[model samples]
Target chain A: MKKATIRNVAELAHVSVASVSRYLNNKAKGRLSEEKAKAIEQAIKDLNYIPNLAARQMATNQSKTIAVVVSNIDDYFSTELFKGASNILRVKGYEAFLLDTNAEQQRERELIKTVSSSFFDGLLFQPLGSNIKTIQSEFIHNIPTVILDRRLATKRWPQVISNNVTASKDATKYFLKQGCDDILILSSEVKIASTRRDRYSGVCAIANPDQIHLIELDEESYNYVTIKNKIESFLLKQKVRNKKTLIFSFKERWLLAFLPMLFADGFLNSDQVLITGFSDTKLVQTILPEARLISQNPYLMGASAAEILLKSLSGEDNSKNYEPLIVPAKF
Target chain B: MKKATIRNVAELAHVSVASVSRYLNNKAKGRLSEEKAKAIEQAIKDLNYIPNLAARQMATNQSKTIAVVVSNIDDYFSTELFKGASNILRVKGYEAFLLDTNAEQQRERELIKTVSSSFFDGLLFQPLGSNIKTIQSEFIHNIPTVILDRRLATKRWPQVISNNVTASKDATKYFLKQGCDDILILSSEVKIASTRRDRYSGVCAIANPDQIHLIELDEESYNYVTIKNKIESFLLKQKVRNKKTLIFSFKERWLLAFLPMLFADGFLNSDQVLITGFSDTKLVQTILPEARLISQNPYLMGASAAEILLKSLSGEDNSKNYEPLIVPAKF
Candidate 1:
């Protein structure tokens, strides 16, 4: 099959290549007659030719692409949330630039600065646990940015996040209703971050002080072996886990390490131990079918965030009026 | 906190700012004393000052970034596959540019052309369906592109895809073992593109001719109403679904449309109507708990694709001799 080109379309339409280019460039001004314009449109249809996007973008200075800066591409929550935002953005005829922070604190802030100065029309960021301050100081400026998964503690910028406190409380309560009185919640260095802190408090909201066990893990020391040992030791110290308990997996890393131990130590025996956590991996279901888990409505949260940020870009009075949007979680 | 800068670092280390800048830029070749280099490195650590990436890229003509041209960023398969690739690429200190083609055949080809001419070190593409022949001309020019998910049927490009034929047959046998004889296989335009056709043939290997029902939807009409109508009409036409049957949702969009109808029409009564499909969504288990699904190992596939692409870029000829790499689906 012969490939179609600008020349072919121009020849078929009986117009100069320049006129055809102007029409395809969406600059269909009085450069061409109506009959010629109609003929060019018909020729393009007949040939099934699409104008090169690069040339078009360069010509118009409008690429319609948004840059998404995620702290870690491997984080299930971040990826899922991004999926939601990208869905809406793509529907709106925008492409996403999926930039990674590689789970580094400073790298995220640096990338944000780069993105702001880049050709992107807007940005969506998942700030790293330790880079919140820098992100606020250097990242979210000049361009319209919507923060996802993590919330900005201060009202310096427009942001969006899942209803962490409410959702965790609901999840904790679900475990509590299953007769779990002693719930051990895992806390990561991310506790310094607002989302983890809110989720931690949520567990305390449902369980008594003595019944709730908090195990703190350094984000830096988070490895499979170290996590497995900590979980085993925590279970050993608890001795008798009579109630269905929840562990607020500050991130997916803890959950990934904790699951194999449950079966290895006979910790998860279907009805006896109703273990629940905030997780992003679907493999959790295959590993422990009975465990109640919190699924962050990443897609909806992301979509809402994109919609919020785009509205802000259009000069809406969202800065003062927009309440912290609380998207529900799926259990 | 005052922002860290080269001036602050120079002052902290009691060194001239020019010396610090030269050291940071790696231009201190025999020009700076060993003591000066040590002092600058220490000052950099103490102040936590980092060079501007955009400035560095501009000065060195090295962006240290790779653009990923995908068909759709919102698709679970695309996102998960990217998660795998991005994880590896980031670890290697490369930023990824995620470009969504919106499954536009013209744009898919155009994006490849654009990326080839862009400032990216290499390109990773997930070709949009079967129209990959559009890119064959450009791909042969050798700009370090590793095609993924779907392979080029007419021309062999450096590509990665799942073992569609074997995986689909295995999936079909699983459905058959569940006592399902009357099976409906949902497919996309089956894009003689790569896996779709292979997967379809694999199903034929396991099931009899009349037992297999192939339903292909229009790619142009991707609306919810259009998809729902096509599915409902197909299901209503089937006469004897008396035996235990299976609905093989070969693609994500198919499953997205099919599962809802199963719930709405009360098809999920017992294990008799076994719903099985290839899914990458966590919601699959949550929404359709009883369905048997063969999850795509997108993360691993992506990681392997990156590793292979890098190896080729590093001048390794191992990839060329290797037939298209097919990562096995984790059932």
Candidate 2:
């Protein structure tokens, strides 16, 4: 069989060769119409044409790749987010490279420096710290990046984040109305990430200061035994005080880790303890059918971030205002 | 701060600049002694030297990047595998790019063709189907590759896989000896992956043909309703026959998806059902404390594959014989 060429695709799609070239280069946003783009895509697919990516990369000075830097990769939330971004990037003729920082700030800084110096077209970052300065210091080459999940202290780039504050506030308000006065906010360290801080603030907004208690787990020292002991102590205290407590988890993994311990200790079925938190999967519901959950659609958040980054890469988004794109979480 | 250069590193380490260059370029296998290598590493760390990967790539015709092709990226098993491989590659100054096939053969073929024609230093592939022919057709450039998880029909490359057959057979034998005669093997499309096929064959070897039954779920249409209905019917049939049954799940996600349904329907605590299969996380034990699990250390398997690929890329492995390295799965 003969190899398909640009001219072949152009002739089959009934478009000019220049139009085909523009579309292949991802410069066809305003130059070509939707109908023409669809026809060209169909013609290429029908002809079984695989464009030479290496040749194209050299010609355009673009690697046609995006770097996705996440805190951790072997988790439910991070993997789903990566999957979402990767799916969109793949359809747009780009590959997403994952860089795991393993939730270490030093590693995150190193990775960001490496990514800034690398030959990637764009970046999707889920930063551990307030990374505006870290990014500004090394991002001299100005690779377009879209921040995911957490917000920076001062926004220098577009961000896609779940509505953590509103969801947590509303959930807390509901619990307050239900006459559950004592509230315990279980979270990972809240200083580094804006997500944890926002959720904590949201709960504190409606609850009494004296009635609210917070336990922050250092991620580096998080273990099954530690979590089990903490939860057991909390439950015992609640039982002695004869007070109903709402256990609000700031992250899904924390909830998943501690819920089993709660079940094992027979604390789940008691009327004194209630549960609610940020969950991304149905696994939480499967484990506790009646637990109120704040569902943050991480996959959708990742896809939206990728779309924004793609637009910025193509010069379609020229706005200077760096307003975040907030994806609402379900209560 | 003054920029650290190769000269500075060599002067600090009391070694020649050429030796430092060779170490940075990953060609210091036999040429540099262990003491010299350690000195060079410490000096580089002390100087905080960041090697220019782009310049090195241009000079050595090495991209310092690897492609990891997997069936799916969103699942726990795949993510764990990728995490392990990525960790090893990063320490070796190579970046691992993930290309998720989404369990599509056509997509896998396209990706393999792309990787073959691209500038990747090596490949770690978890292929679907007996893809020896598919790989050979486009592997004209002979990118050093290491097969992962599943085996190909022909031994064209070194493989790192779990001891699927042995572990499954031993577990099945244990259950058979315990007088659990009726066995239902639940899997996702056994014909496509050797991991599933080997596991199925292992169970078949231990169980009676008349008592063994296999239910294959199409991945595209996998859902709660379908899984729940299938399990309900199987349990009903076992109840009618008054026979004790063992439910063996081939993958972690499958067990996770259906275990909830089994628990909801009150089948978990019944004396008629025994559960065990391939699980990678402690979530299974948390959910069903008594459920026996065959644990495949996916992370270790992935790291082993990356190590093998790195050795081959550095020209340290000259053997032509492709012997498989089996990572033992715990039963």
Candidate 3:
């Protein structure tokens, strides 16, 4: 059977389409006569007309809403990603709501229940600590979703990951060119996300095994005092060889916490050590003029995910080309 | 005179309340026998029963949604306030959506149209560069609203503002006690918001006209290079006097940008000058240990606004007591 449209209701009731619409919206007022109102009501009953909301929802599984799952909404990078996605989503006539998991994989999994229970039409996941199995759900597969900046355990979902390898390798190469014999890579969590792991690997790719150093700070012990203590110990150990050393932090918080303490304690000498990290930290970069950075475009990555999700929502499924949309990092 | 209830429909239809509910929700399967379905339908028509969504909306003006208006959703302070409001709102089962004004007053006024037109049940406005006239809207007057931080032209609405005056005075007094002859205040924008004006007045209350110096950095002209140049000039003049000076910054961005440049130039000597600002810069504080802060609780201010708005929505009218709920700043 054909769907009942406003025009069909108008033709059956022998009323103008505008009048039918106004009556349905409760805006008919004096424009609709008593006889005309009764006639339209009888026509609506005869047609068994269910409202657009009820029928369309049952048929399409579309809410015109999108859910953006992030590690933390308050984080600088996640918000930038949200801004990017929202810019595109709003243009496409969709509303995006945010859910912050606070870097917990368990919460992300739990959040999926809410996302799938007719709350949203689509999902955009930026998992903090997740595997492929949880992401490739039977329920999620029914709706459109795009993952952003996180590597999956399997090649199942469309993804947009920034180029962590090239940027980290370039920063490391810069340090090696400056005659640095020892390089230390410090990060908040070593294996929580592939970004950190890839950054560590990129540095390893350039340097000899003996010359490379990696320090993975546990999340529970992440504070300026603890990070300062760790860096002090690391530098103390490196001093024995009198090697010209270089330091690379994988995230902004680590760089902000570590460098100020190191500079204050006279641990950084202009000629002895060089520093750089991957973060779009204008103020930190300005403050620490000697410390260079590998700036990545989180906003672009977010926008790419939104574009892919939009395409998938339309059933175009251009996931083949965008298995992993690679946004390059700039030094 | 009383509204027809679902229980009345169930009684008239000779069906269980659960069966009536299932039929109304379109959840009734073949188990609801054909006779029961027709009977319930007839009962609904005879009683002139309407769905909860339509009647509840018309009678209660409630969408169970609140819109939080801020200058920048991504800003450190604004997001902290949003987090506080969202925490309380979520407990009350209300979802908060964010709108970033990007510091434009005109855009906020335009956004009022969307907020008024079924987009939200209430408004929590944190205006930037907005005069009270623009905020005092006939549309907004009909809704539950609470102004946060920004002062209104009239005491018509509830407000939640941090104790900018008392905190600024204490910092100035501390500087005065330190025998500081020269005092300088650097702010992002002056006279835009009452919070800024109050902070400026608090400093003026303590210092003589010659003792107090004010520099209001134009927003359009604030970048690393410009900020660095301005701080360089300011510090050069302060250094020329050979007198112990005290510096106060009104916002975190200014302090973060200014201090690093000063430190790199070996210009920030703890013995020569003392620095304090109004922000809870924990990591920044840990990094720049010499710089003290007059910490204001943005989260508490946001929570206070949420509490008042919730009260107004429930018809308790707590605005009389909370005309300007002042959350104290800790130094």
Error of 2 at A200 (Å): 1.2
- The true-versus-predicted C-alpha distance at residue A123 of model 3, in Å, is 3.8
**Per-model C-alpha lDDT, please?**
0.65, 0.78, 0.70
Tens-digit lDDT track of model 1 for B1-331? 2335455676788875445545655544358889887887888898766553322332233456677777665466776677678778778777667776766776666567656654456788887765554666544234567878876654345778888888889888887877776787777777545778888888889999988887776554645455556555555554244466677888764565445444434444445566667777554543454566877877788888888877765666544444678788766
| Best candidate according to lDDT | 2
A1-331 in candidate 2: lDDT tens per residue? 3345555777799986446656777644467899999998999999876554432442254668888988876556887788789889889988887777878877777777777766677899888766577756755355688988888766568999988889989999999887786888888788778888889889889888987888887765555566667777987988998889999988787776676556645676677788898988777776677777899888898899999998988889887678889999999
Q: What is the DockQ of each candidate?
A: 0.08, 0.14, 0.18
Candidates arranged by lDDT, highest first? 2, 3, 1
For model 3, fnat equals 0.17
Alpha carbon lDDT at B240, candidate 2: 93
What's the TM-score of every candidate structure? 0.57, 0.80, 0.79
Highest TM-score among the candidates is held by which one?
Answer: 2
Per residue, candidate 1 scores C-alpha lDDT tens digits across A1-331 of 3335555777788876546656766664466688888998999899876554322432243457778887655455666666677778767777666776766666666677767755566788777663455666775345667766676665645677767788888887777776765777776664557778788888778778988777776544445456556666766655564444555575654665555445434554445455677766454543444566777666677788888766765666546533566676666
Q: Model 1, residue A33: displacement in angstroms?
A: 18
- List, in the given order, the native-contact fraction of each candidate: 0.10, 0.17, 0.17
What lDDT is reached at residue A170 by model 1? 87
